[model samples]
Target: MYKPQLNMESLERCVKSLEENENNVRDEAQKALLNICRNVLRSPNDDKTREVRLDDEVVVEKLLPAIGAMECLFDVGYVEDGERLFLPGNVSLSRLQSLSKLLSAVSESKPVTKDIEENSTAQKAFFKKISKDFHNVMHYEDPDLQKKARSVIPIAQLEIAAMTKMRHLQKSYKFSDARKTTSSTQFETELTAKDLLLVELLHWFKHEFFEWVNSPKCSRCSTECVYESVVPSTNHRCSRIELHRCEKCNIIVEFPRYSHPEPLLTLRRGRCGEWANVFTLLCRSLGYDARFIYDETDHVWTEIWSASSKKWIHLDPCENVIDKPLMYEKGWKKKLTYVIAYSKDEVQDVTWRYTQDQEAIMKRRKICTEESLIQFLRSLTDQRQNSSNYSSARKNYVIMRSLLELADMLYIPNLQNKNSNEIYEGRTSGSLAWRLARGEIVQADIEKNYIWDVSKYGKMFELRYNIVKDIYHVVHNDGTILEQKSGWQEGTNITNGGIFRKVENDWKMVYLTRSPQAQYGCIKWIFEIANSELYLETFKLRTKSEVFHGARVSWKIEAIFSDDKVIVIPVSNCNNFYTEDVRKAVKLNIIVTLSGGQGQTAWQHAQVFRQSLENIEEASMIINIQLKNH
Candidate 1:
């Protein structure tokens, strides 16, 4: 005769209490025992009665022996009788699974059962209650969840969209996988630029931005410690603190579990909460509209908006995963009931996106009614949208569009029947063409022509002397032209020129050649007497302005001579002279001087002068000096 030592009703009640309880210690113990039972019964055999018998035998013979293995694996205690197992109110999922595996390995014998159908009803009801409680626990809402979500989502979006350091990161970490993967073969045949950018950003956030916190050494002995316990935080700065006991010296240390993202950024270390929070912030810093996803099963991650694909892509910073929503339920074998995502403009129930067993998930969602949940989310969304600075029509349109998107996700027939492109057009104009029309979100402004007031810097005018075959021509901005014999003669004067000034938005030339001392004869050299002080001042101002506007400015001097000869050179100084000695040494050598902001000055001489400026009939030859900003 076999009698159960553990009352199934008591265990079932404990599992049910797990859903309503807030105490961490009691909940952990219940979760551990329930997980062990789930793993033990999760065998491939479908014989319900045989499984029940095997489960009982396993609990008595194999499971009790496996408790020793769990004791070694984790800092937890357990008590067991013939059929019931009691835990020391502290257990982690990892150690639970480890114990369950050990039990399964030891209890390999098949159980014989004759009354399979008779026991099926009771077994089903017991398991059903356990499943319901487990689901309720998974969806249990944290008081601060909504607040954290709101703080993180919009900022994450801004971070990823505006990130300028991406190119450097891309060079170091190639996004080969991003370019290869398509969102869906049926709809999105190719990866768009936004898609690729999102993937790259995920990689950057995971590999470059965040790092895990290593366990601290023992304070007394300086030896590595094993994590032992956790105390839930009473205040807002942190969520909890973990206890680590040294293996060598029996010394205990406390490790604070942080919840804030700002401090975590500087500390650069933490578990999933810190990782997700900081990652969300980084995503927003780059200007990619993002959402902070809160998994009810004690995890968090990010989701970013893809304008090109017109969807939100899942990104797990800790796992370096992108667009794999089913990883939690399918890969991790997690039974999730709620996956809420929060953004600045909306609160969404995104659970369906991550889970495969929607029916089971819905059954466990007993905390709130569907209508109430929808109303709460809608109210939150409305509060956010109404608080925004957007115009009425734009706000309505955005809200309507968002609701349609939510409908599409929920498979509400009306909106889901329409193409995604149509929904996008409802928010924008017709078609998804507006995103393409907007162009790149973060592009550098192209440099354009800038007008510099010469009066503010130096003299607004200059003079030039050119020699054509048997022609000595001197030109000035004052509309004065002087011609002398081609050869230098005795008593010849060569000081005549013109001075130009900018007045009333026009260049007014004053003739200096009217005086006898300003007259010149047969001189074939160019001389410039610029104000060095003004040149330096103007250069500094120009460079400073360019830098302030995120640009660079450069100066060049070009000299045109008679007989269609032209010489161009770079300028870098306040005083420059084109002497005849150098001109003869290097035929057509022209001196160019430039002085501008930030102590930048350049002087260059160009020897090539094949192009001639003699085709012009005007007496004064034009010397074009160009200032370019880049």
Candidate 2:
């Protein structure tokens, strides 16, 4: 009746004894181990008092929250771990698109297959796991890909082929049988780690609640076809080509490698064109007969002539043709059959491994280069920002993950759990939150776990992770710029843009509106999320130095949502900043703040200000720039 405690000793033993005989015992044991790992860092050892009300009656509150300096906790999955977990086959397609973003940050020169060619059991297991995970995501209906020879396709082939492989490839290698279980070498451990994680992920997919095999089937009669193919009869529309099963035969595209056939064996959501692009990418990377059909479908799929298997095969990820043909007009018994349609783009002047102009190759290389990574990170930074700059901090969440991928590939270790933000925060070696904000840790330390290089485990990858993490913040131009004064205290005399010094005595407040004239999307934020959160206990500013002065200040911002900022001078106008063009035309002199941060980089404002149409036409209350001539 008693549950076991989750601790390192128990969990390590649990992971070691993964192939247990009993399922229930294994589940409980694994749960205990994973829970201990996941909750290790979150234990009650902190000092900050924070309250989180889960609901009116329920609250998960933390007080005396002590931020760990060197305390380490791992987030291995347990029961609660399902919250953020990628539940196997149910993972979102948009989430998988994240792989594009993930790989985009790494250098092209870096090897994409750190775990691919390992000559050990663990290595083979890891590769298999990766291949299997990839296999689940792939829904190509084509069944002929298995017979193709492997390796990079020549440029000539790509030019002649219909499809070209580009990125994201998974391949496998095996160690000599005698050396597969040799635990003495580091390779064995690396292989084990890779394989175990991969298999775990596949098992997760296989047991998914909505796995293809679990998809609802047609209730008409007892059953029909259980195939994963995109079979459509000439007389039937796609809406009618729903899931079905046949009691006579378990009709599904069955792979020799798999014991059971399921929809994932060859069914993707996209049409022929989308499926072709994937095949092209896969085959180009692995040398195959992938071609782009230049017809209305523009379908890009791969092909192979299996001399042994006899039939010419198609790796149509869009339609699994394992048991039968995917009909085109064949559904209506029309002349244009599936075979005829596929034959349309069968072969043209170009091959699958086609090369492009030097510009494209250079461009792809540049975009995914180490230098490019640095530039992107720097582009995200605001050089003039002090500690108070929280405007673009949210983007750092994505940045953190992308940088982590790069770090892991380079064999970085300390980077795996780096609180490296100290460099960006302009602080000493100690940064509490930075350590916890490792959103990029998962992919950044990808292959570092089991590299062959001895120094790599200790230094190389560790160094890379640190370097990448530091660069990300640097690119973002992050730092804790210590002010000349001890603490920040605002006052009434907030210069044109800066608030006054004494305003901080109590929380002096003012109403800000989107400038009447904003050229770009600058005015969008003010109307969008300006009043999202409220600041209470506010002070007010007078229209003029004294109450009811003739001069007034006009604002363009509108507080839309949450609590409103108290407005003392609701309707007023003052000398708004003037433009040089207007100044030259008027021949009048007035002092005003001309430029904020302008024209330095890509995304900034102050150079071009525009007024919205509503503000211009609906002149119910007017606040125009004033003139002062001496």
Candidate 3:
């Protein structure tokens, strides 16, 4: 009799080694096991049934020991009855999920016995049931979407590569810090210079490549024309052309409504649809991840992925607006029904991002059942995944990650429980920044006077002020009296008098003041008076400060006062003054410190104030200031 020696400890060592060195060592170990099974052992009986039984016994006795030995080394607990192994903490969540699913699948495949024929029948039935359920949920029948998705595949690859290179190039340029707070700030933050290369390309295409097609001009007389009637497309290849007649020349002009992006690239202009289609295609061409965001209120835009931020930022090529998500709803005051974002890999209902009142917006959603919409999106996602060149595992990972991201966006907390009327009123109230920009003087009635304890940017400060004989007796939050000079009119002196006006049921005190030198500029202070408490919402200042090289410096300062106080802390020996060509430039270096009430420092920034004494003149600069309490 010949017997095979099974070294469980040696098998365990080899299995543990596979974790560190998987390829070569694992292959060798597998081969050695196979060779041992084939050459070392022999069947005891000559009967085929007995030989098969002996083979099964040999496999179970030899291989099962190795598996059991691995349990100790891997720290995995195995249950014999259920054939379930408790995975170690080191295993990933996805890996654990996959293993659990595999175990369930294997159990279902062999419900009664481990017979191969029965297992195969069970597997087929399971798959058939899954296929039926999938079809029932995903009943979308849009061939055009499928065709478009397939067409963009090659375009996406090339564009992604180009955008990657552009991002690298953009890293080399330095932008000014002053531009960070402007309207373009959101765009700049979302898309840096590197990101804007793609935007610039799109902008160029919009201006040079695309033409704005309105009414056609008369060919004979070169006169402006109006559309007389629409001539429908005769075939699929040709678009519907409009028959236009020139009012001045009495000449007819034919205008083709080019709907496709491929032809529109050459034909050049249609409307919002044509522009969005071509722009989206162009974005895809640069390898940039993009989506066509269709607003049901007859508008369309594109959103490109910002790799740096890991988010899709809004980009409107037609308006040259980037990352202005609130432009339509807040800026344009458009009531949106639905804002569906469609990408090659997925579809998302992103209406919440745009609309302030979700309840009002939901009332207008009458297109399809939510269930059917989800099914359509799932179908599109499936088609895209099928068309994707990535492996099954990679595609599945991407799909899962995307769904998680969408879920996160959909469940964000709604802080403002504002109704339709409140939303409208809030918008009309015009923020501190808006009123300051317009340099508007607003007045309100002061109901009563009381000292207000305020904090600006976490720095504690108390305002002591009262209205006496229609004149505001104002004092600084630090108990310092503001300078009220001779020949100063009430409400016109920045440090002294102010007028109040009613705004949104709150009294707004509009105070005017000038800098230490009127040549520097004038500052307007608007304080909101509510509950006998004064709240500084905002301040606007227009100042002409002297800089170096005889260059006059003009500054427009709009400061929004919050709960946190802005404290100017002077720094010793940091100030540097230099003269260039007899023009002195004073650079006042100080640390802008911010602290909370608990005596803890919140934030600090080093600020350098530069001024030139070359063209020192009374600039008549107007600064409007407004304050907001939150």
Candidate 4:
């Protein structure tokens, strides 16, 4: 349970110390730790690996002196010990991932780099003029991007193995009834079957198909490795190769960091770059009009045109997130400069969709003037559109969509307790230290307690007070048992010996009984209005029983609108009926409280009348209401 933090500085020191050793002690230690990590990863459910004897020869000789290796082992849930290191429970998948990251860190030679490539002739020339850093933003303009994307379609389509995986992704959730609303945005049209497929694809790609490589395993010894240097690659598809030395065997291993998705289909590894590349290609293979989205702050993702929403929707295969445009800026605290999206037929500067801090982003855009950048984007877009042969009507629709998106970007809303997509936390896929190094960690605020949050129906209620714990019963005047408890708590049943007493002539009675120890008991019921134009004509409350022993009854009615506005009406000892016109009520709350009551509180039937604006048809709004005593 007590997991120690992996200290990279200590690990670096240990690596250096081991390298300076006169014998093969360092190799033996590195091999021992690597074996432990590999075994746990390979068969996490094996009970044999749940504990390690601290007195074992290898642990005492090879691991104890290797402080860094021991630290990593402790970090990955091997710290529990009573003279023996014992894993407390089933190995956590996250802890296993953390172990992999630790193995990569000591062997890594350089920081993680972006997968960069020149897009077009103009883009290549432009990068030559501007700083090389800006090329990440401009690489989306590659005219042959679609051709490259289409290349991988046959891999997933023609191959029986790949098709089996794709078929697995198509199996949808049984309860997947499509809705027009998401957490953040509501669409004009309901989600189509295609949208659901894309959602399923994201899940399958992240969990099943892809594996993130922090550091490639050594081909010779399959143990820990150290990065040596870059070398020439014989393959034309791969532009460069990285060499890593097996810490155990001292054999050189070649890692060809390929950007091409074709080979990536077989390799199925790398960081965010490979993820986005293969995922985008897969999207194209599936006939979804997908875009390769490039973030100037060194991230890559995908976007697809949604036929239902009639706009581009953001999808991050690496994070398994969809339509969370603000994740990079708000969640990851990334200082974004330019977020450009490129598809076969178009290229656009979509940075506005991702961040609200345009002023700061513009200030950071120092590699090229804003005007020149705009000109370059426009020139590239124009070239694509002119060649694509889009009709006049199609062009107008595209322009209109862009304007709508721009307007949406400029419009700021009061997000407090409103925005459904609460992307206020950091990245989830990477290791803790890796996330920390990337400045992607965000401290979360205190969690909130919600009374009701059925966001799918666009309804939510915030309760400030903890409800009274006592239970109560609602019965008819003749004691025919309108409603009663069903064994939720001990002694919840009402007194069974007596029937309700008859009320005054021509008046029926409904009563509520409070718990004996409770000072104040209340019952509240919620009513959902079916139509917007319905209005409450009158609310009548009459006491059937005369007051006795300083007992009192009070009632409150709350009409909550769709905009979260609430109107409250409270009345006490209402011997006479009252008429109040409640209009356009989306939800209605009725609460009746009996305070300082020793006996049951009887009412001569509370009646609520509703009338439609179109037709004056009166109806009782309350039906089958329940009462709970304090």
- Using TM-score as the measure, the top candidate is 4
RMSD of each: 28.4, 28.5, 30.1, 22.5
lDDT of each: 0.42, 0.24, 0.41, 0.53
Residues 499-568 of candidate 1 have per-residue lDDT tens digits of 1111110111211111111111111233322322322111110110012122222233333333345556
Candidate 3 runs further than 4 Å off? 1-193, 235-239, 387-390, 411-630
Deviation in Å, model 3, residue 346 alpha carbon: 2.6
Cα lDDT tens digits, model 2, 1-630, are: 001223333222223323222554433433332333233334323211111111111111110011110011121111101011111121122322222222222223332222212243333332343233233322222344322212222334433222221111111223345445543354443333322322232232223311222123334432323323222234311222322334344443221112112321244222333334444444433433233332211123344423233233344343332111222211211111011112211112111112212232232221124343334324323321222544445346434533543443344224322522321111111111111121101111111121111111211111000111111100111322211112111101122321111111012211121121111211111001112122112111112111121222233322221333322122233322222222212111111122232221111122111222223222111112222222
Could you tell me how far off, in angstroms, the CA of residue 117 lies in candidate 3 after the best superposition? 47
Candidate 4's C-alpha runs over 4 A off are 1-188, 232-236, 388-401, 412-421, 443-630
lDDT-based ranking:
4, 1, 3, 2
Put down candidate 3 lDDT per residue, 1-630, tens digits, no spaces: 001112332223223323333344434433334333232123212223111111122322333223222222122111110111122222223322222333333335532223223224323332343343233222122345334533534435445655776556444333656454544545456556447466556656555566555455578766556545555687543456656677766777787765455566556676566677777776665556777777755467888877667667787766666766666765555556667776655666677766666775665444345565566566756776787474788588666657655764564325223332331211222222222211122222222222222233222222222221123323454545443222112333132111122111011112222211012222132232232233443322232222332222222222222333333222222222211211111111111111111111001011112222222321222222233443
CA deviation > 4 Å runs, candidate 1: 1-14, 17-194, 213-224, 232-235, 388-394, 410-630
The best candidate by lDDT is 4
Model 3 residue 343 lDDT? 66
Winner on lDDT between 2 and 4 is 4
Alpha-carbon shift of residue 113 in model 2 (angstroms): 29
Report the Cα lDDT for candidate 2: 0.24
